[model samples]
Target: MKIAFVINQTHKEKAGFTTTLLAYSALQRGHSVYYIGLADFVYLDHDKIAAHARIIRQIGNIADTQQLIDALKSTSKERVFMDDFDVLWLRFDPVLDMINRPWAAAMGLQFAQLAQKLGVRVLNDPRALVDAENKLYLENFPEEIRPRTIVTRSYDDVKQFFEEQHHEIILKPLKGSGGKNVFLVNKQESKNLKQIVEVICRDGYLIAQEYLPKAQYGDIRFFLLNGKPLIRNGKYASVHRVQSTGEIRSNIHQGAKAQKAVISPEMLQMVEKVAEKLIQDGMYFVGLDIIDDKIMEINVFSPGALLQASELNGEDYAAAIIEDLEKSNGKNKTE
Candidate 1:
């Protein structure tokens, strides 16, 4: 089967990340792959989607890592239609370069939907993704599984929220990732809260919620594939991400350490309730941020954790993810 990954940019990726591993695994399975970037996709007449893709033939017997990457990058670019592939994985992290081209941020979801309409299987179905666009989507979870929250741009709205909570609050842009512009507001920083709100809210909505006191330890990030735990050798694809000592954000991109984690019952419950909906909505792969068992965020587009989770569990999680993709796509195409 031919598999193509629609990404933001190839040069932006680093070694030991989930996206790279998945693409490599696909090649190891003898499947052809095309790595397409944001500008690669072309919308033709009648909504046909296409891109110039680098067709990676196979992973040679080279043991050295860097050379293997060189071989992967050496493929010639070819214009491949989205309908030609059995699966089109939207592995690009839009938030990474969203500020650069705001319009291109939605291209993955938009084209994924188009490709699906043409009978190609896409991860995290585009329809579900459109609904999961912002942090406010977290509120759709069971109330018991989410932290007390308020979404508003009104100054009075934020003040009343802080007054009611009367504790440290975690404020961030409603539509954001990698913990960009996230803030921890307390009595000492109360005055700055308004400024923070002014900045983030100007671009979009703001999220001001009761900070989970337990976040100091770290947050547990769990990966749910096809609405089930992708556990192998008794290890689930998950990890505890500890923030940089005094920092409130635990996103690994912001200097967080990944460690083994215990999947609490609350975490499992939340994943189960949300995963089915995600899969039903065409989300094959996803990640959920759990702090004190409250669902903080649900990453539908390019939900990455395979690398860190695989590192902690002593198994390559990308292999598991790609295997699942093959199985699901095979089943769908056969049916």
Candidate 2:
């Protein structure tokens, strides 16, 4: 099958990371692995999509990992119709980019939607990504599993939320990802409350949630593909991200270290309950931020943790992910 990976620059990604391994595994399986980034696509007014893709030339004999990497690196990219590919993997990590062009992020989804329309399977459907962009998207989970939450920018509303929740609050930017500027506030720090709320609220809405104190230990991340738990043997594809000393946020970007996690029944239940809806929403894959027994975040757009999970479980998740994509494409089954 002709598979195209929409990703960040090659060589820059850490070796053994899931994205790299997936592409490597795909190439090893003799699938035509085309690596395209955000800069590669060409969306047209004719309701058609195209991309100048880095289509890999198959190597006759096997060599080393570097040889395989160099082989795909040597592609002479040319414009091609999106309809030509059997799969268009939207693998770019939009949230981590340095965007001079904000429209580029939105455009990737636009093109992915078009690719799906053209009969190419686009992972983690474009529409779900748009909704997931909002931090309030976490509210879509079962209310019992969530803390007292309010999505509002109004200062009065936030203040009232603080009062209602007894200032047991965690504040965050609704538009932000990877735990940047997520503040855990108590009534004693009321001095900084207004300023923090104002700054985050300026972006869009503020996610004023009752702080889940269980977060002090760490957070667990569960990777789900095609709305099912992506497990290997008996171990699950998951990690317990213990935050580096003094850090409140356990995001890998925020210096969290990945350790093995036992996926508890509660965690599985949460993922199961949310899976069908996520799959229905074009959410081909996602990582759930399990803080305590509750989900703090649903990372749909370019969810990480596969590499961490791989390390923790000593299994090849990147290969598993690529294999799943292959199966999804091969079977062409419906939800």
Candidate 3:
């Protein structure tokens, strides 16, 4: 099977990214793999969508992730039609390019939606992704699992929410990621409330969430493939992220250390609660940021840390994911 991973940028993709893991795993399974950057997509005549993509074939038995990345970087890109691929995985993070290449991520999804219409299996459903362009998508799910949240662009609105919540809130950009603009505010330190709201709302709306007390202990990044936990040999493909001292964000890129996650029954039940809607919406893969019992965030586009999960759990999670993809592809072709 030919699988193409659409990422933010070819040069920016590290060897350790989940995209690289999946791409390398697919290649190891004797499948042709391709890497397409967000800005490389091209729409040709006859409604045919193509990309100036880096296509990798089994060349001299690539051994490691670095070897796979080196092989791709050494090769030049060619224009490959989107319909020629069996799977089109949109792995680009929208917020990564929200400032610099603001138009790039949206264009990538627009192309994915086109590829889906052309019968190429696109993961996470591009159509649903458009609706999930920001944090507000969480509101579509049962309110029970989500934190007390309010989206606003006005400083006064934020102040009201802060007071209502007794002056403890987690302030962040509604359209941001990687903990770039996240801040924690309390009643005593209200001096920065106006400034924080102003800074966060500069780009878009501000998400003022009632501060979850468990956040200090960090959060668990639990991955769901096809709306269920991605597991192998009774080991879940999930990781517990513990934040470094003096940090509120537990993102790996933000210096958080990854460890094994203890998946509680309550967490599984929470997954079950949202699984149906996710499946119906064609969300084939997602990462739920579970802090205690409440979900902090839902990452549908470009969820990472799979390698960490495998390393911590001692399971070949990438192989399992590839196997599932193959099975789903075969099932789809027959139906």
Candidate 4:
């Protein structure tokens, strides 16, 4: 199978990232893998979409993901046509480049959308991704499964929402990931509410959500592939992230520990509620941040921690994803 991962930058990826694991798994399976940076795309005169991709052909046994990362970094890039690949995985985070290279992610998605139109399968459907670019995407799901929230750049709106939620609310950048700029503001911190809103809104809009008391215990990072739980050997590919003491954000990169997730019937029910829409939207791979019954976020763009989940569950979740991709490619070929 020919698969190209569109990432923020080839040099910026880490061995621990889910993208690296998936790429390594594909290489281990003897498939062609390429890494395309967000700024590497080109549009030729004949409507051809190409990229100066970092190619990592399947070679001798790759010992680990670190080795793959080493090879990817050392290897020189070559122009590759996007349509020739079976899958063009959009794995770049928009917020990462929102400041300096604000045009990078948008241009990458535009190319991905064009590639999809030109018959190359694009994951997470770029058309839907345009709308799902921020926290507002969660509002598209059933209201019962989401926290009471308001998105605004107005300090008055945030202040009003905080007061409505009993002076307790979660403030975050509407388009951010990895818990950057996430804050748990309570009554005691009400004095700084305006400043917090101003900081978060500088990037774009800010999402002020009713603070879930259960968030004190952290949240679950649930993985879903093709709108269903990714499972292997009777274990689901999910992780329970426990934040450090006094911390409110449960993102793994934010001093949170990844433990084996305890999936409940209620969690599965929540999955069912959002499954149809996700499948319809072509969000082939997804991560949901759940706290109790309400989903704090839906991660469709570059969700991390699959490696941690696999390590905690003692399963090869990356292999499962690659195998699924192979099957999907085969099915598409037959169709």
lDDT of candidate model 4 versus the reference: 0.90
RMSD of 3: 2.0
Per lDDT, the best of the predicted structures is 4
Clash count list over all predictions: 4, 2, 0, 0
What C-alpha lDDT does candidate 3 achieve relative to the native structure?
A: 0.89
Better of 1 and 3 by TM-score: 3
What does the lDDT come to for candidate 2? 0.76
How many clashes (backbone atoms < 3 Å, residues ≥3 apart in a chain or on different chains) does model 1 have? 4
Ranking by lDDT: 4, 3, 1, 2
Candidate 2 lDDT over 133-236, as tens digits, reads 66677788778666678888888888888888877788997777778778888877877988998888665677888888888989998888888998888888
lDDT for model 1: 0.77
**How high is each candidate's TM-score?**
0.92, 0.88, 0.97, 0.97
Candidate 2 scores a C-alpha RMSD against the true structure in Å of 3.4
- Provide C-alpha RMSD values for all models, in order: 2.5, 3.4, 2.0, 1.9
Clash count (model 3, backbone only): 0
lDDT, each prediction: 0.77, 0.76, 0.89, 0.90
What are the per-residue Cα lDDT tens digits for candidate 3 across 301-330?
Answer: 888899899999999888888889989788
TM-score of 1: 0.92
